[model samples]
Target chain A: MMQKRTIEIGVGVFVAAGIAALVMLAMKVSNLAAFTNQQGYEVTARFDNIGGLKERSAVTVAGVRIGRVKSIVFDDKDYEAVVTMNIESQHDRLPADTSASILTAGLLGEQYVALEPGGDEAFLKPGGDIKLTQSAIILEKMVGQFLFDKAAGGDGKKEEGAAP
Target chain B: MMGWLQRLGSTSLSVFERLGRGNLFLLRILAALPSLVLRPGLVIAQLYSVGVLSMTLIVISGLNVGMVLGLQGYNTLVDFGSEESLGQLVALSLVRELGPVVAALLFAGRAGSALTAEIGLMKATEQLSGMEMMAVDPLKRVVAPRFIAGIISMPLLAAMFSAVGVLGGFFVGVGLLGVDSGAFWSQMQSKVDLYDDILNGVIKSIVFGCVAAWIAVFEGYDAVPNTEGVSRATTRTVVHTAFAVLGLDFILTALMFGDE
Candidate 1:
């Protein structure tokens, strides 16, 4: 009987430990639990190319995350990516004329929205859109353009030399 | 040459025969699983012995492994000037691969060997035969509970392993090495995905548990009724479980993360 009680207690502890581990895992991996009830205001921004910018990516002001990308949708009429950001209440003092740019952490890492505040007395409302926005830079496209320019310049120089 | 061919054929045939028998034994244990609810005491006892007893080693090894990852990862990432990502590296490695695989290996070594030995000893002493004589189904009464207990305990043990490993990484990265504590945690939270990394790991551990428990119980049930036979069966249980766990881990990883 004593052994039976001890075994029961052991099983209980084992189960509790399992639950605790699972809770910790969910928190550590998802990161959603922490901000589920966060008081925030949503703002929109338009960009030509969002690239690999994912929802839930951080929105940073001066390298500190103040919010997250709430959702993303494509504006078919304007042919642009419409990104919605949920800024925490504490960061509600962002100016109306602030510019948002998609920036990558490290060289080839996750993309986030970096906000640069402007010197404006007006503050951004909950549904206000940030008109000044910069899209993600595609490395391959940039490299291709650089090579094309170099080849084009070399061809012109060679043709001038041949004519002379 | 004909004699050699005959020997090879016979050996292959025997191997297939053993495999078939092992499958049948596993089927019997699984078929008796429904009856386990009626014998909760038996299952609980097995759970205590298998799961609870194995916790200490799992936690200790998990912490040590995490610390090693933290130290190594910090050194490497510091070279790249991205030591802030130490938590991400440690958490991803532990949750995705080492946590499940290492915990399962340890389980096989600690609890699996003990299970095989216990059941094999019971067979050698004719306890199984006696149970049969008493009209009790030895597989249902003895083996089913243990199999279920192992299956249930495996995922829990693996989760515990990962949690402790993360804590260990935290200690080495933040407390000892002067890494910014907030970056260590926030980086991990932002990088690791629940469905991709953590859930997949839990699935791996669960599958490993099933394989290890199946091998252990089957080996014991099929052991020859002698001291030597019992010892050999226990050894085979450890060897077979290790191979099965490792092989299954590769296949699962491919299926889970292959596209990425």
Candidate 2:
């Protein structure tokens, strides 16, 4: 009888410990747990290119996180990327003329949306759009442009001087 | 040449026969599961033996593995000047793959071998036959509880491993290596998803649990009813669990993480 009681107590403790671990994982180790309980409003932003921006990526205002990118869909009509962002209710005072840009965190890190708020009498409302947007910069395109300009200048100028 | 052909054919036949037998045993255990509810004590006791006893091994291994991951990830990411992402690296890898896979393997080694040996010894000593003589179904009384305990234990063990592992990584990264504590935890939280990473890991552990427990109990129940047979069954349990866990991990990973 006494041994059975001991076994039960041990099993109880084991189960409790396991459950506590799961709770910690959910609370401390994942993002959804933080945002799921809070109220948020969705707003759309359009970009020429999204680069590596993914759903659930951070949306930050002045380097402080305010919300998450809720969804991304291709705008067939405009030939652009339509991004839906979920901004926390606490950050509702963002100005109407806010600009949304896709920016990489480090040199080669995950892409996120950065919101640059413009001073306006009106504030951004739910379902409102951010008008000013900058697309993600492609490094290869910049490098190719630099090389092309240098090549054309080097050949055309050098040949003119030599022939003269 | 003829003798070799005969031997190969017999071996193939026996392999099929064993597979069929294992399936039948699993079915019997499933059928007996409903009755297990009437007697909770059996499962609770088995839980102590199977789950509680294995806790020490799981916790220690999880801590050490996390520490190693933290150190290795820090060293590698430091070269790129991205040591702050160490938390994300540790959490993602541990939650997605290492936690479930390692915990299941250790389970097979600790609880699985013990289960097989315990049941096999009973068979060898004629306790199983003796129970049958008394009109008791050994499958119901002996096998089902152990199987239930094993299946229940694995996911919990894996979760604990992941949680503890994250802390272990914190110890190495923020404490020793001087990674920013805020960046360490914040990056991990933002990058890892509850549904995608943690819940999927739980699902993986559950599947691994079913496979490991099924093989362990099946081997024990089907032992040759001799001293040598019992020992062989114990060995087979560990080897089979390892292969099944690793192979299934690949298939599950492709299915789960493939889209991402």
Top lDDT prediction, candidate number: 2
Worst 10 residues of 1 chain B by lDDT: B189-198
Predicted candidate 2 versus true structure: per-residue lDDT over B1-260, tens digit per residue: 99999999999999999999999999999999999999998999999999999999999999999999999999999999999999999999999999999999999999999999999999999999999999999999999999999999999999999999999999999999999999999889988989999999999999999999999999998999998999999999999999999999999999999986
Under CAPRI classification, how is model 2 graded? high
Residue B83 displacement in candidate 2 (angstroms): 0.8
Clashing pairs in 1: none
Residue A77 in model 2: lDDT = 98
Listed in order, each prediction's TM-score against the native is 0.85, 0.95
Q: After superposition, how far is residue A158 of candidate 2 from its true place, in Å?
A: 6.3
What TM-scores result for chain A when each predicted structure is judged separately against the true chain A? 0.87, 0.87
Clashes of each: 0, 0
What's the distance in Å from true for residue A114, model 1?
A: 2.5
User: Model 1 off-target regions past 4 Å?
Assistant: A28-30, A38-45, A61-67, A70-98, A106-109, A116-130, A138-164
